[model samples]
Target: MPVTDVTTDPEQLTMTLTAEFEASVDRLWQVFSDPRQLERFWGPPTWPATFTSFDARPGGHAEYHMTGPKGERSSGRWEFLSIEAPRRFEVIDSFMGDDGAPLEGFPSMRMTFEFEADGSRARLRNTTYFDSAEALEQVVAMGAVEGSTTAMNQLDRVLTGLREYAQGKGTRVEELSDTLVRITRLIDGPRDLVWQAHNDPELMRQWMLGPDGWTMTACEPSQTVGDSYRYAWAPLEGTEGESFGFEGEVLVVDPPRRVVTTERMAGTDGPSTINDSVFEEEDGATLVILHIEYPDRETRDMILATGMAEGMEASYARLETVLAE
Candidate 1:
């Protein structure tokens, strides 16, 4: 899935969302540059959007209207502030009137979109800055979180189509058995870089995090067979938790090739889940195949119900950002 995280901080007067795509940075950037593609996923599925004008360069403008299922239209405008092709851009987003003028006395936000590349994968982070806490709360109260999440979900589907079209191959998620789930994707990076990103502690810390404001405070990766590793995560403040983390034992380690490990969740004495990651290089990109095996069907279903896929997607997205740097 493309969208992995969406967060709102009233005190900070900001909202941030992150997404991952199975495409190169330049390819993923087109979704924002091309008005037609932007409109396709810019709004919630229930509210289709149409763009009147779009100029992606700095000092350019974009205007669009999203029509609700009931035929109500919400007009929006973006005044581009800065632009860096295939990487980052900033704009001021505001409500607009039928005359293409920004509405007064309404919340206008400073929005920045950063596109980061990881081999053949891309990560996008959007940060929206509000004028004040009240302004931030206003949008949150207006269902911005729920709406953005839905819209981003639609973006993921659109990205999948783009990936399939570009590579002539589609990513896959399969339920191999009652207790196993398999995920496969072709990433545009050499096998060595992909392997290093997973094995190196510093590189792992860069992307193996949960979401915004959450970090992997401790990381110990033993890349050799029969070794153990531990990683701990610190949650955002006031999130009703002290800290939670996980540990695992490495079973097999083959450089730039494959790794097998059994992950054990902290605070739980349940069966440890086994993970096998295989990397294959074709041309210049790497094909990643990951198999996750649970102890039983009930355990697999329970973890799936917890939305683990989103967290995994977020982690992978962060990895893209790290790789880009």
Candidate 2:
């Protein structure tokens, strides 16, 4: 187990757990900043977590549920209180009901995580403060210690696998659930430049073209929430493909960090998909992680069957060239 020690103070109504890892402090921080990585080890062995929404910033909130082997689910929410990149973060953690509200009679706690470099490795100090001793005791009795220990132990595999999983992979797709899919690509550029390439019409027109022999004919991008944007593409002369386009309304925008939008094919009344894209910088490269929620399983499968991942890879490869220029 990575947990080196676990201590509790009844008088202070607090519990603290210390753990060490063979990864750098920055690498350790990525696991928390990226929801995809956070879900990998946030729950115990038999109960795996799935984060439907994660916004890792002060005042932002995250919602997740851990599903047990028997299909039972335990939902939770986190209200980010403070954050200091590669160092520390704090959140108000609460049990959530199926209706997405805090569960009554459940005690919420203020949890803080601190990370630091310890010689060649990294160390994490996680502390949880309860409202009272009773609250602390209640969680302990609910197997909090054991569950947390097992969860942290699973982090080793995740930390070790991240680099090999994404470093050179052009564009990777993962089916997070029946309706949700995640696509990630590490672009060789800074976060701000990558964000500009996505939002700036001229820059977008340069690289958003999915495959060779295709041109972006129209690029109307939405810059504000509630506003709609449209993009159209056409095959170059003699190329075999039909012209098509997509339209979407922007729901949320945090410049150079995250954006949420609802997308659907233009000129069609098909069900729309919610797309949440996040940008994070690691070692000077920006990683683009997109979570796409389709209306149903059929829609998700149909989109994937259309060779979406392959097309995205081609676009991303072109994006790198644009960035280099």
Candidate 2 Cα errors over 4 Å, as ranges: 1-106, 110-165
Question: Residue by residue across 1-325, what tens digits does model 1's lDDT show?
Answer: 5789998887788899998887788878887888767776787644556798998778888989886533467899899999999799999999997787887767999999999987788998999999999888888888898788767765654554533422434345667568778666666667899899887988888888765667788899888777788889887775545577888888766577667788888667757888877665656766666778888999888877776666766776666567667
lDDT of 2 by residue, 22-117 (tens): 999999999999998898679875466779999888999999998653346899999999999989999999999999889998899999999999
lDDT of each: 0.77, 0.86
In model 2, where is the ten-residue run with the lowest total lDDT? 157-166
Identify the leading candidate in terms of TM-score: 2
Question: How many steric clashes between backbone atoms does each model show?
Answer: 2, 0
lDDT of 2: 0.86
Model 1: lDDT to the true structure: 0.77
